[model samples]
Target: MRAVQVTEFGGPEVLTPVELPEPEPRDGQVLIAVDHIGVNYADTHQAENSYLAPSKLPLVPGGEVVGRTADGSRVVALLNGGGYAEKAVARQDWAFPVPDEVDDLTALSFIVQGSTAWLLLRRSAHLAEGESVVVHAAAGGVGSIAVQLAKAWGAGRVIATASSAAKRELALELGADVAVDSRAEDMTATLLEANGGKPVDIVLDMTGGSTTDGSIKALAPFGRLAFYGMASREQPKPVELRNLLGHSTTIAGMWLPHVFTLPGNVFGEAMADLFALATAGEIRAVAGGEYGLSEARAAHEALRARGTTGKLMLDPKR
Candidate 1:
C-alpha cells in the first residue's frame, strides 16, 4: 500500500511517500479501503512534534478517513494513525457508516471538526437559544463547523473571526451572522458591538494565546468560553479568577479524546445529526484542496500556513 510516512519530526518536507504493507484489522477493529483522508491542523502539529501529546515515531500522519469495507459499505473512521494510505484500520466501535445521502469527501469532514463543533455546543459550552456566540478561527475546519452549528442550533447571533476578508466571507457563507478580523486589536469591542453593545454569552475559542484572554474579558455574566485547542502554538494567556468571580464567567476546557472516553455513542450521535443537517441543506461541509495521496507534503505545508479553509482531503487512489 502507498502511504506517507514521517520518520523524523520537522516540517512538511518530512512527510515522504512510501510503500508499506497493508494493515490487517485487529480482533476488535475493521479494515477500510480508504478513499479520501482528512487533513487537519493537528496533522501539522504531529508532523512538527509540536503537539501537546507527542506523536510516536514513524507515524503515518492521518487520523481520519472516508472509505469503504470489503463488501462495499461506505463508512468513515477515526484511525489511531495510518490514514494517509490506500488502506487503514480503526476500532469497530469508532467506525460509522456514511449515510447514502452524504458524499465521500463531505463525510470525511465530520470526524474531528464536526464532532468538536457538535460537542462544543451540546456539552462544552451549553449554548442557549438567543445567546450571542463568537467563534474564533472561523475559516478553518473546526471553526467553520462551529460557525454553522452555532446558527443551526439556535444561537441568536454567530460572530466569526478570521485574519483575512476572504476567510471572513467564507464564514458568513457557513452561516455566521457576522464576520470580523481576528487580528483586530479591539476584539472585545467587536464582540460587544456584534452583540448589540453587550458582552457575549458564549465564545468558542481554540487559539490559546492572546485570544483566550480577550474572550475571557469579553464574556458576559454567567457566560461560558469553551477553550479547546492551542493552534497558535503558544501558551494560553492566564485569566485571573478574580475577573471571572463576580461576572460568573467560566472557562471550560475541551478535548475530543476526553469526550470519547466518557462513553455512549457520542460520535455516532453527532455524526447522525451532522449528516442530517448536511442533507437537509441547513449545513454544508466545505471541501477544500484535493490532493493525491503522494502530495502529502504540500497538504501539510498548506495547513500549517493557515491559508486553507474547509475540509482538506487526500485521494488515496490517486
Candidate 2:
C-alpha cells in the first residue's frame, strides 16, 4: 500500500512516502479502501510527537478517512491512525455510512473538524439562541463550520477572526455577521468593536496565547468560552479565579475524543446531525486543497503555514 510515514519527530519534512504492507482488520474492525483522507492540525502534532498523547516511532499520521469497505458500502471512518494510506482498518463502531446527498469530501469534514465545531458550541459552550458568538481561525476547517453552525442555531451575532483578508472575506461569505483581524493587538477591543461595544456571549477559540487571554476579558456575564485547540502553540495568560467568579463566566475545555466517552453515542449523533444539516443545504463544510498520498509532506506544510482553508484532503488512490 502507498502511504506516508513519520520516522522522526520534527516538522512536515519528516513525513516521507513509502510503500507499507496492508493493515489487517481485527475481529471488530473493517478494512477500507481509502478514497479521501482528512488532514488535520492534530496530524501535524502527531508527526512531531507534540500531540496531547505521545506517538510511537514510524507512525502513519492521519485519523479520518472516507473509504469503501469490502461490501462496497461507502463510509467515513474515524481511525486510531494509518489513514494516510491506500488501505486502513477501522473499528466497525467508529465507521458511519455516508448518505448519498453527501459527497466524500464533505463527509470527511464531519469526522474531526465538523464534530469538534458542533460539540464546542452545543455541548461545551451551551450556546443559546440570540446570543453573540466569536469564532477564531474563522476560515479554517473547524472555524468555518463553527461560523455556519452558530448562525444556523440562531446566534444574534457571529464575529469571525482570520489572519488574512481573503480568509476573513470567506468567513463573512459563510455567514459570520462580522469579520476582523485575528492578529489584532487588542483582541478585547477588536471583539467588542465587532460586537457593537458589547461583551460576547460565546467564544469558540482554538488559537491560544493572547487570543485566549483577550477573549477571557471580553466575555459577557455568564458567557461561555469553549477552548478546544492551541493552534498558535502558545499558552494563554493565567486566569484569576476571582475574576471568573465575579463575572460568573465559564471556561470549558473540549477534546473531541473525550466526547466519545460520554454516554449515549454523542459522537455518532453529532456526526449524523451534521450530515443531515449538510444534506439539507443548511450547513456547508468548506473543501480545501487535495493532495496525493505521496504529497503528504506538502499538505502538512500548507496547513502549518496557515495558507489553506477548510478541510485538507488526501487522495490515496492518486
Instruction: Return the lDDT, model 2, position 159.
Output: 98
Return the top candidate by TM-score. Answer: 2
Candidate 1 residue-wise lDDT, 10-35, digit = tens: 99999999999999988999999997
lDDT of 2 by residue, 225-252 (tens): 9998898899998888999999999999
TM-score of 2: 0.99
Candidate 2: 10-residue stretch with minimal lDDT: 254-263
Q: Provide the TM-score for each candidate, comma-separated.
A: 0.97, 0.99
